[model samples]
Target: MRPGQRGARGRRAAVTERNPGREVSAAKALQKVRGQIRLHLLSHRTSVTASGTLHLKEGDVPYTATSRHQGTASVAIKHIPQELVKRKLLMINGDVHDVPVEVVLILKATGGPESAGSSAAMYLLDWYDLDQELILVLERPVPCVDLRQYLKEKGGSLQEHEAKIMMQQLVEAAIELHSKQVFHRDIKLENIIVETGPDVPRARVADFSCGCFARKGHYHLFSGTPKCAPPEWYMHARYKARPTTVWQLGVVLYGMLDGHPSFDTLRFLRNKLPINSELSQNCQELLQMCLSKVPKQRPTLEQLQHHPWLQ
Candidate 1:
């Protein structure tokens, strides 16, 4: 996932104070990186970021360099990696030549905050910080496509079985993240990528730039895409982590099957289009439970996992 996923215009900045010291040159800093340039000036999708492809000479590891100038001091741009190092090497097909391991670059500003919680659910390969830039060396999921692009290839929507499989993996990932007290403020199709294997494709969650460590009764400020914000946030100006996550899950499920969001406004979510005959009965029930107008009425991740639709 990229920093520009979901609503970039409304991204929350790094909660830490800005570093006012003399900035280091990003290009000069990258020169010291232990890698060969495979692709120079790679086209980064977001204008706010610049990225390139790199090949680590040490282990023949392939990685992607995602970087952004601290220009405009964007909150997502301030998302740099913490010092915690966790490594995993997934050997797909039992062949080293196959897909490499998916290493997520979980970032937090240096000396910003303790991020033991946020990095709990993913692997941190390597990270570096310059005075004005934070660069991450992330393992790219090869032979994979983003959920959004995959949906487009499927004529804008997914089949029921395919949707079920993808959503199951995503739900499990969400539950694991929440278990670590890490709130992935943004969860959308764009943030998930599916590996295209010969038999079964797996969905992997990416891009923790908008994520933060949070526990019950701790998260208060708005931190995600406005469209995914729950009714409680709009009506009462505050929202809890669990309920809002459930709402975002509902929105993503709907988008997967319907090719678009279920509703655009709080009024619409509360008063209009409450039913969808296109989906199975259990699936519809799950959506209703997740998209409930009242946060208290929404299902917890535990309850959602036991739902019939997922089973």
Candidate 2:
């Protein structure tokens, strides 16, 4: 109830983001908390804004039946606002979460891959039946730093030898997940984790809260961040699920070496998209195959690894 910076375990804890209602440290030392970002929901407070627009996102489930939220991106708003909040706030099996539980589970389940063994991710706690609340234990990576910062500081492009090393590290990790039949639908600078150890920078893909498992024969349609997404993942925008890891892999490769994608535009599929710089022939060719109109045309993870560009 009191608003002031308090000490945690005798160390000073700043009122960092949003103030917490209370901070009681238990045995494990996990902080019982409040949200950093408070959303205006239809929970005994707020008004209706809009309705009737459908949206698509990565993974099997969606934020809503309409109003597309693509890729690893977190949506701050949706078309059917109150309806969605009511479901999240009230808690019901049929209740729809802004972020689908399956997505989070899929991410959590990938503690490790064919080789990763166990990358860090949050653990899910049960929901309260009455209000549809979710409890998650934050499991930060052992040595946490994403590629986004490094990419930005470097100002695009990697040296030949360095690129090769990064490519191999991420590729092997990716192959490990694919072997387990997992598609880390969202792969980008924001998700790759660099451990602070002697190990060769093993990349642990994060944001599985947007990942969907591709069953042996059950294909589900969805969308990803178009900038980095394969055409099959973007064009259909509602097409049945297919193998998109290959596509995303290519995009990330482009991003790593170039700082951005071959396409410099933001939200390529969205309106008001600006003119993007031309991509190099090698990069364009790779993106072309990855962004092929058809899903079946894209190369497999192993095949992409062996491509001439990689060589």
- Distance (Å) between predicted and true CA of 97, model 1? 38
Across residues 101-172, which tens digit of lDDT does each residue of candidate 1 receive?
A: 122224311111243222223333344433323445444444667778988888988877888887787788
10 residues in a row with least lDDT, candidate 1: 37-46
C-alpha root-mean-square deviation, candidate 2: 12.8
lDDT for 130 in candidate 1 is: 31
lDDT of each: 0.54, 0.45
Question: Which pairs clash in model 1?
Answer: 13-75, 80-107, 80-108, 81-107
Off by over 4 Å in 2: 1-108, 111-132, 216-220, 237-242, 261-288, 308-311
User: What's the lDDT of the predicted structure labeled candidate 2?
Assistant: 0.45
lDDT of 1: 0.54
lDDT of 2 by residue, 1-311 (tens): 13223322223343433544333332112222211111212121222211222234323342332112335322222122222222122222344334333323333344322313353333222111112222222334444466776566557665545656677677776776555445556677776755545456555565543454444443334434545555544444443333467656656666665554344223544533322236555555665676555668887777767766666
